[model samples]
Target chain A: MRRLIVGLCWVVIPWYLLSLFVGSRVLPFPHAVAIRFAELAPSVLLRHAAASVLRVLAALLAASAVAVPLGLAMGRIPAFDRLLAPAAYLLYPVPKIALLPILLLVLGTGDVSRVGLLGLVLVFQLLLAVRDGARAVDAHYLLSLDSLGATRTDHLRYCVWPLVLPRLLTAMRIGGATALAVLFFAETFFTRYGLGYFIMDSWMKLAYLDMYAGIVAMSLVGFVMFVTIDRVEQHVGRWQG
Target chain B: MPGVTDRVIACRDCAAGYAGRDVFTGVTLGVAGAETIAIVGPSGCGKSTLLLTLAGLHRSSRGTVLVDGTPLESGDPRIGLVLQQYGLFPWFTVLRNATLGLAIRAKRSGRRFDAAGAADIARALLEQLGLGGKESDYPRRLSGGEQQRLALCRTLLLEPEVLLLDEPFSALDALTREELQDLLLTVLAERRVAAVLVTHSIDEAVYLGDRVGILAQNPGTAAGEPARLLLEANPAGRRGVGRTDPLHHQACAWMRRRFAEAVRA
Candidate 1:
């Protein structure tokens, strides 16, 4: 708690001092932004925040649901790994944002495409994380499970899934940030509501205070997502501690 | 004592390897029910490979491992293996690790496993093995010796007909090693389960084995090459026997000479 307060002071104080020196409409003082944020909080800010959060959550859920099983299969089965490894290697490094145009063409500029774009961006991060995590599991554990007559499903449930969970959560934390970035970009185009759209609209209308407020809201969402993931990791990775 | 009988485990000219590269071949050995056979050899001598083959974790490239006069299938649960690293699942709690095999068995047989009953059995075994009150703790929380014992507990809970242990105590300090050895002896004596123990320690080999086998330098390379039986001495009566025992000392001396000879050859 003390660390958070100290960190906030460091950032806020520097920005406040900088704003005082700039004395420009583009860079509003912190108090002016705070007042603007309060003015917009009840209706305009809440709706946009809700829209952005919904998209991010939906993308994360969809990505995890697809990536985890596919990753585990790729990791555990040598033949499957051989088949998919080259494809994963080729596709993982390609910037997913670059596919925005292709996705936009196929799915049109609807919520589906936006969500699909975000999900597509996050899936590779999660898949690679889970695959590497499963591969990194001690061979001894697998042998032990095998010696115990663990069937394939038994091995997956008891051994593979639990072992890869922490890595998957870590991947989620990383992918969450990427998802948010992609979400902002996706929302900016053909989106009626979102923090991204709000911020861009505020900027165009010379509402710099409101724009800062939108940025603050987006940062809070990212912060909350990170903290939530950290907390879940702590709970599941209790043995590690 | 219930399953203790003349259910022999025999490796008949067994050959095993990885990726078509032979590690060992023609490894023939036999253990009568309730007998403990300890194998001693240098590193890369296929001692562990032989154990894995016998346990059915590794498929034999030649011959067969027979349990009770039938060829053993891969991953036969009746033959419990304790690997050198203990092989405790890090994700599972102590109690859960102990009951893993039984739970799987239940699931396989289409029987609803009595979790409460299994927990009671696991708890009793843990308490007996000096792991009382650590049922909720994961394997990472336990010391090396504790983890080894928990692994043993997991195997024992399943009542395996034969036990294949690969250097089960090499990582422990001398004192802890001896303590675990004694505990192992007690368990074997009580259960009378047939066992094959592979170790680099000559003294441990002599102390644990009814008969000690020494693998050749590059065992199982040729068609006829296999682990040759080095000594046949009953150490069963020597339970709790210290290193000072004349027979124990004699066995150790004989094994060391034979081991040096095998390595040289």
Candidate 2:
């Protein structure tokens, strides 16, 4: 908590200094932005923030639900790895943003398209991370469990799952950051419900204060996601500490 | 040491190696219930490989291993192994690591796991092994000796008829090693479980083993020749034999001389 406060001070002081140096409507003071954020949050900012948070979370869950199992299979099953590894390797490097238009066309301009695009962006990272994690289980632990008369199911449950969870959580954390960035781009198109729409709409009206407020809200979403993941990681991988 | 029919675990003419290289060959041994046979050898003499084979975690290329007069099976619940590294899962709590064997047994046998029963059993063993009040602590937080105790506790949970240890206490400091050696003595005597202990420490082998075996390659043999076992009864082998006992010292000295000749002659 102290570190967070100190970090906020570091960022806020420089930001406030920059705003004063600019001294124009384009660069409002941090305090001025803070007041505008407080005023707009209760009415429109909260709703936009909620929509954006929901879309990002839904996308993250959808991607994880699909990718984690696939990645675990790839790591453990040689035949499955041979089948899917080439596809994952080939598709992982492609800029997922380029598919945004296609997704928007197929899924329409609803939240589904935006969520789908963000899910596509995050899945590859998580898939590769989890696969590597599963494949990297140490031989020592495997032998230990084997000598205990553990079945294949017991091996997966006791040995593989616990060892791989921390890696998955770490990948989720990194992926969440990307999800927020891609969420911003996704919200800007054919949608009036997200922070991306509100921020861009505010910018068009030259309401710099409101745009800053939307950006802050979006950052809060990311901050909360990260903190949640850290808490879960702590609970699962406390032994690592 | 005994007739093959009276042994709880017996290995005859067992030879094992990785592809393209032999590790150990022509090994024969038998352990009756509650007996311990300790092995000491030069590095790369395949003492660990021999123990792993006995544990059924490795396959011997020749001969047969019999447990209770039946052919040995991989992952047999009646045999437990304690490794030198104290193979407790870091991601699990001390209690969970101890209970893991029971859970594996339950799942392997198609029986529904009774969590409460397993916890009770695990807690008792942990408490007996001096790991009480540490059920929730992960293995990473425990000291080296504690981690080893947790490993021992886990293996003992299965109540196996035989135990195979590969340098189980070589990592601990002197005082803790002696402490654990005594603890192991008590447990082995109480449980009447047959055991094979592999260690570099000749004193440890003399103190704990009813017999000591040396695995060493022949001095004139080619580099490709695998190490072979030289098993003998220990002069000082008995329960609670003092480390400084004259017989213990004699036994350690005799074994040291034999082991040196076996490894370097």
Candidate 3:
């Protein structure tokens, strides 16, 4: 009950403060910003929010598909770790936004480019988390498993997977947030829909109230997404103890 | 004496070590049914490595380890080992872990678990070990003593013919450690399982072993193999029957000198 009330307050109070009062110039009354928010229309907000969420989720799914396997392989095999670790370090230092021009050039200014760019950024983050988590597993546990006559595959599935999964979920939480942030910047480049495009459009038109409103929308979406994943992690991967 | 009893595990001219240096060379030992041998060694000796080799987890550079009269292979199932680390799978509930050995063996045999039979045995074993009412608990939730007892239960649940204990009680407090040591002696006796227990404590070796084997380390050398069983004294006698007798004390004194000599060798 308390949580529900708090959630309602978070939504209602922020919408009023951003849409009604704060603006490029002080408004005499709350009615003017309210009229402008109404002008943005329900259809436009729904369409743009849907587009943004679909793109981000698609990118995240793609990233998870590729990065998890690659990370697990690198972690299990020492030679692979040695070969790929340096390259991963080198690529991670490069700001993901810097890849925007190349992505746009190759994939064009469509949703494809935005989703692909988001996935690319997420790969480095999730893979690093997987590798570190796998490496952090206790050597004794692996040795015990080996002594039990477990095959390598058995060792991996039974021992390594459980040990690393919680950490992997944590990584996803971080990676998802980063992907969302990068998507905003990436979309600001060339996009017809999404909250990023909406925010830039409002700013260009000098509608400061709409700009703040879009910012609030993006923040709310990111926070909700992160919290939802965190809760799922706790439920699905109950701590061993 | 050798073949009459049917030697379950035989380490023949075995040379074992860590990181390439031999700890002991041409070391021969035979463990028969219901026999309990304690390995007593000074600190930094290769008792742990020897246990690993005996368990068939490590390749002996110079010799062979035979189980059930056949050459033992890597990760041999005939040998069950418990380490001081208490390497219980933290993700598994106590029940799952206790049945892990049976499950693995059943899978290998292409047979499903006799669930009722296995559960009955697991419950009885846990009850004996004082871990009843905690079947659903995971390893991390257990205290150190509980974990050690669970580790014991897990090993015993397999009903392995030969048990290898590598300093299984070193991590516990002194009282708990001694209690566990006694519990282990009782369990091994009850199950009639041949066991090789490694420990740094000479008193423990003397107190529990049918025959205590002493190992010594060379100074300034990590690679020097601990000296072989220069002294094999049965202070505790058969099944620890005469453990507190004067004969036990005299045997301990004799073995103590041999251990000191091996260290200075």
> Can you write out model 1's per-residue Cα lDDT over B1-265, one digit (the tens) per residue?
1232234788666678778866766666778878888888877778898899889888888888888878888778679999899888777799989999899888877899999999999999999999999999988889999999998999999899999999999999999999999999999999999999999998998898877788764432454344443435544344345777786776677768767776664
Q: All candidates' TM-scores?
A: 0.91, 0.94, 0.86
Best first by DockQ, ranked:
2, 1, 3
Q: CAPRI band of model 2?
A: medium
Q: What tens digits encode model 1's per-residue C-alpha lDDT throughout A108-153? A: 8888888888999889899989998878877777788888887889
Clashes of each: 1, 0, 1
**Residue B80 shift from truth in candidate 3, angstroms:** 0.7
DockQ (0 to 1) for model 2: 0.80
Q: All candidates: CA RMSD in angstroms?
A: 3.3, 2.2, 3.9
- Per prediction, fnat is 0.72, 0.89, 0.50
Q: How well does model 3 score by local distance difference test? A: 0.78
Candidate 1 residue-wise lDDT at B246: 82
Q: Model 2: per-residue lDDT, tens digit, B1-265?
A: 3476459999888899999577998888989999999898888889999998998889989988899989889999889999889888988888888988888888888899898999998898899999999999988899999999999999998999999998989989999999999999999989999999999888988888898888999777877699999988886756457987788888788888888788774
DockQ of each: 0.70, 0.80, 0.51
For model 1 the TM-score comes to 0.91
lDDT of 2 at B265: 49
Weakest ten-residue segment in model 2 chain B by summed lDDT: B232-241
For each model, chain A TM-score?
Answer: 0.94, 0.96, 0.81
**lDDT at B198, model 1:** 93
Which predicted model would earn the best TM-score?
2
